[model samples]
Target: MYLDINGEQFRILKAESQGAWLVSCDAPGPPRFVDQRELDAYPRAPAPEPCTAEQGEAPQTAAEQARMALIQPLLDNGDCVSDPAIRRQLAAEAAQEHGTTSRRVLRLYYQYIATGAVMKHKPRKRRPPEYENYYKRAIQTFYYSAKRPSLRDTYDLMLHQFFTAPDGHLADKRPTWPAFRHYFYDQAYHRRSERTIARDGLTNYQRTARPLTGSAMTWKDHIGAYQMDATTADIYLVSRLDRTKVVGRPYVYLAVDTATQLIAGLYVGYEAGEEAVMACLANAAMDKVEYCRGYGIDIDAADWPSKGLPSEVITDQGRDFLGGRMKELCLRYGVTCEALPPFRPDRKGLVEKMFDLMQGRYKPILRGRGVIEADAQERWAVDYRAQASLDLTQFTQILIHCILYLNGRRVLDSLQMSPEMLEQGVAPTAAGLWQYYAAAGKSALLELNPQEVYYMSLPRKT
Candidate 1:
C-alpha cells in the first residue's frame, strides 16, 4: 500500500491492530475490535506499512562508500583532531586508500560496511562553544561597561552571567579564568589597537618664572625649558554626595617634573585657582625629603620633602594659572612661569600626562566603585579651604608635608626610578651590583655622591 506524505509517496498500510481497523504496512495485521452492530459502519484510514526505499529514497551505493571514505581517519587515529580542509582531504585519501573507485567518499564508503571500521570523535580540549556568540556578548559588554573592562574583567563578567551549571552538582564547575580568556579576551587582541599619541599642552614659561633671576631665563640662545602638557584627567569628586549630581568639588592637582618625571607637587586643587597650585607645591616639599616616607616597598602614607622648587612652572595660560598674582609669585621665587598658548596642553606635557594617569587611568577605576564617602568628602573640603587661609609663613609649613610625602614619593616609568631615586640613587641590581652596593651603603658597598648619582640632562637640545 502507498500513501503520499508532503508530495513524496511512502508505502504504508495498517501493520498491526488491537481493535476496529485491521492494519499491516508489511504483513497481515490482527483484526480490529468492533461492535457487531456497526463493525463496518465508520470510515477507516489505512494502517502504516514497512516502507521500502524508492529510487531516490536512500543514498546510492556510491554515496555510502564516499561518506565512509570521508570519515575513515577516526578509524585509523582514534584521537586525531580534524581541520575542515584536512578532514575533506582525509576522506579523499581514505577513499584512495580503501580502494573505493570513482565515487564521492560518501557514495562508496559503506560498500562493505562492517563493525570496528569507524572510530568515534570527541570534542576538542579548550574549544569554545559558539565562539561567535561569545565574541558578540563579551565585546558588547567590554565596550559598554565603562572605560572598557580589562581582559580579566571581561572574562569574569561572562563567567558570572553566561556560563551555566548542570544539575546534581554540589556547586557549579566554573571554568578557570584562563579558559574563559582563551576565547573572549584573546579575541579582542585581534582588533586594531587604539592609538594614544600624546600631544603636549603646556606653554613655554622659560622667560621668567624666576623672580630672582631678573634676566633671560637662559643666556644661551634658544635655550629654554621644554614644557609639555596633557589634560582632562579623570578626578574623583571629593564631596558629601554619594556621587556628583553634576560637576563636583575638590579635585587633586598633580604637577610633575618632566625631566625627572617625578610628581613634584600634589594638592587637593579645590575647583581651580592660585590657592590650588600653591597648596600643591606645599605638598611637594612635604613629600620629598624633610619627612620620612623612605624609598621603596609600597607603603601608603605621604611625606614632606624639603626640595620643593622647579626650574620652570609650565602650565596652560588659564586665568588662574597666569594671573598677575601667580606671575608675581613666580618672579619672587625665581621660578620661570611658562604658559602654553590657549588649548595646547602639550607644552606642559609632563604634568598633562600626570593628569591622564590620575584622571584617565585611576579616576575611572575609583569612580566605578563610588569610593568617596560623606566624611571623606567633608574632610577633603575642609582641609583644602583651610590650607588657603594660611599666610606665606604658614603656607610654607603646609607645603612641606605635601612635597615630601606626596610629590617626592611618586614613581616614574621613564627611568624606572622613584622621586627618592634621585637623592638615593638606583638600586644595586639596576645600576649593577657595585653601584647598588654603593648607593645602599652596605659597608662593603660605599655610598655615592647625592647629586652625581642622578645625572640630569639640563633639557638642552642636544
Candidate 2:
C-alpha cells in the first residue's frame, strides 16, 4: 500500500501492532518505521495480494551453515561463563560494547537457548550527521582562519552560518545552545591560537605543542639545595617604623629548600637594593629562634631548625647575586651560588610556582586593599595603598603564618604529599619534618661563622 509522508509517496511494506508502518521512501535506502496516524490523511493504494516470504533457491555451503550452528550454541551459553554472577558481568560488558541494555542481552541469550536461533539487528545511529558535519567544517575553518575568534565565537559563527536565514532570521532547523557547545568543544578547541581565544586558551596550546617539561632538580637530603628569588609582594604596606607612611609594595626575598619545599627564610624590604638579598641569605643561614622572637611569634627553635649554609643556592644572574662580594661570601661558606641562564625560571619552578600559589591565597584576604594591577586598581576605584591595614611587621607575621601553613599542610601536587611528609617519613607538618631531620642528623646543614658570612656578603664599593 502507498501513502504520502513528508510530501513524498512511500510504500507500506507492513504495519506494526503499535500503529507504526514499516515503510520504504522513494529514496534509495533502507526502510524506516513511520507513524500510522501521519499517513491516515493520505489515500491508500488498492489492496494487493498478501506478501509471502520466499524460500532460498541456493543451498548454503557446509561452512556457512556450520557458522550459525556454532554461533547459536556459543551465544546460548551467554559469553561462555558458567557462573551465574560471572555470566551477568560478561553480559553487561557485551551489552555496553553493543550499545544495548543488559536485560536485552539476557533476553537474546534466553531466546538462543530455547529456539537455537540468534537475533541479528541493526544498531540505531545516535549521533546526528548534521552535528558532525557542522563541527568538522567549523573547526577546520576557524583553525585555519587568521582571525581565530574564541571557541565560543567560532560556535556562534557556525550557528550564524548554519541556522540563520539570509534575511537575518532563525532558520527552521537549529540546534540548541548546549548541543552546539558540546559539539564544538568536542572537536578539539585547543588547535586554535591565542590570537583567537586569548591567554587561557593559549595555555592549552602550550601544554600540547611546547616541550616545557625538563629534568627535575632533586636532592639526596634536606638543605642539599635551595632556591632563592625576589618578587614584589601583591600587598602595599605601612613602614615598620611609622604606620602613617605609605611604603610602596615591598620586594619579598625568599630562600626555599628544594627537597622539602620549606621556606628557609625571607626578608621583606621597601627599597630596591642589595641589602634585601643579603638580609634574606643571612636570615636563611642563621638560627631563626631569635628572629621569630623579634617578631613576637614565640616559635620554638626545634620547630624551625632549617638553618646553616646549604651546599648550593640556585638563583638568577641578577647583579645583587653576581657581585664580587657575593661570590666571596658563597665561597667562604663552601656553598655554590649556581646562577641559572637568563630567562630559565623552569630550573627553579618550585619557588616560582610557590610564588603564584602564595599570591592566589592572599588575594581573597586582601581584597580591596592588596596589590591589584595598576589598571585594575584605577578601574575598580581601589586605593590599595590607602586601604592597606598591615604594617611591615604585621605583614611579616602574616607571611610567616602563610609559610608555616604551606610547610605543614599544603599538599605538593607533583609528589602527592606535603613537603613535611617527604621531610620526615610521617611528619604531619613542615616544621615536624624539619625537627625530625635535625634530630636524626639527616639535615645537610653546614655550620658557618654567621658574622663573617654576613660581612663578606655585604655589597662592597664598586
Candidate 3:
C-alpha cells in the first residue's frame, strides 16, 4: 500500500501476521518517511506503522532483520523524511515487521531522532524595545545635502541614534553588536520562521516617503519598445555579490516617456559618459525603431527631425548630459531635451524610481567581484585571477533575459494593458507623429543648440 511513513493515519497496502510478525509484502523500497514539517517542498501523504521488537517476545526473523538493516542507513543518514505524517507511516512499517503498536514505536523513534538524548525546544522571553525610529531623514537641514549612503553606512547611523544612552557615561551600558547581529545577519533554520529581517531593526527595505506621479503604461510594452528614466536608485552593480571574486562599477541610465512609465532601455555598462549615454539612447531608439514600426508608429526610418523625435527627452544635468557629441546628435534630430536642476531629482522623478528597482532586483547579481571599475581593466583582473573570477561578459547574458522579461511581462501599473498592447494599438505613422508634435506647438519650445546637450531647468528660476 502506498504509505506515508511519518503520520498517525497511514495506508496499508499488504499485510500478513505470523505469531507476532505482521509482515507488509508491499512496503516498497525499504520504509521511507518525510516529515511534512521539515520537507514542505515534497508532497505529503498518510502513513502506516512499522514493526518493532516487543518486551519478553521472541527475536525477529531473517527477513525482518534484513529490513531493519536497510532502513537503518536511511535513518542515520537523516533521510527517511522529517514530516510527522510520514514518520507515523515509517513507524507503522516497523510495527508490521515486529507485530507491535505503530504509535508507540513512532513516539520512541521520534524522540531518539529529535535530540538523541538532550533537551527539546524551549520558548524564549521577550523584552520591551528601547528606541523606536532608526533612519534619519536624508538631511541635517532644509537644503538638499550631497550624501552617499550605503547599507553599512545606514546601519551605523541607526545604531548610534538608537543606543545613545542618556547618562552619556558608562553607567548601565547598552548591548553590543554581537548581541543583536542575529536579526540582520541570521540565517533561517526553518521556512516560515517569524524572523526580523531589517538591519538592526531599521526599516530600510520599505519606502517611508510621500508619493509623486505620472505614466499610462503596461507590461504589454514590447521588449524592444518602451522608454524609461531614472526615478530609480539601484544604479550600481549587484550589491550582495562576492566582491572578492567579481566586482562591478556601473553608470545609471534610464529611458521613460510622459505616459506609462515603461523602461524602454536599461543597462549596467562601463562608463556613464557620452558613449554610454549615446549607446543607451541609440539602443532604446533602435528598439523603438523596431517594435514601433511593427505597430505602425511613425518613426522616421531614414530621417528624424528634432521636433518629431521623442515627445520629450528628460534628464538631469550631469557631465554626461551636457557635452560633445551628445548635444550635437540631439540637435541634429530636433529632439527636445529637458534636463532637471542640479540638486532637484524630483524634477526627473522616473529615473529615481528606476534606481529603486535596481537596488532591489538587480544588485545581488555582482556580489564578491570587488574593485568596481569602469573599464576593460576590471574584466582583465577577473581573467588574470581565473579561479573564482567568473566571466562577467558571459554572466551579463542574463541581464538581457531580465530586460526581456521586464518588457514582455505585464506591468501591473498598466491597469491591465501591456506596453506591447499600447505600442501595437497606437498606429501613428512617422510623418503623422511629426505632424502631431508640430501641431501640438513644440516648435516654440525647441531650442536649437548645436553644442548644448542639455536644456536648462525652468527658465533658471530668474
Task: Find the candidate with the highest TM-score and give its number.
Answer: 2
lDDT of 3 by residue, 1-462 (tens): 232334332332223232111112223222333343433333334232232222123225664344343334325543344344665666677777767677656544443332221112347644224421222231121111224344355445555555555764432444444434333343231111221222212232122322334332322121222233432222233333563543444454666433334454444455456655665565454434453444344344322222112434667787666656557765676655667556655555545655565444544664443322234265445432222343344334434444333434424442443364355453232222323334444333333331232332111232
| Per-residue lDDT of model 2, residues 308-363, tens digit only | 77778888988876776667666666778889877667668778867877777776
Q: Candidate 3 regions off by >4 Å?
A: 1-247, 287-311, 364-392, 414-462
Task: Write candidate 1's Cα lDDT for 409-457 as tens digits.
Answer: 4443334444655466553221122233333442111122323212221
TM-score to native of every candidate shown: 0.32, 0.56, 0.34
Q: Considering lDDT, where higher is better, how would the candidates rank from best to worst?
A: 2, 1, 3
Q: Which stretch of 10 consecutive residues in model 2 shows the poorest summed lDDT?
A: 48-57
Error of 3 at 425 (Å): 10
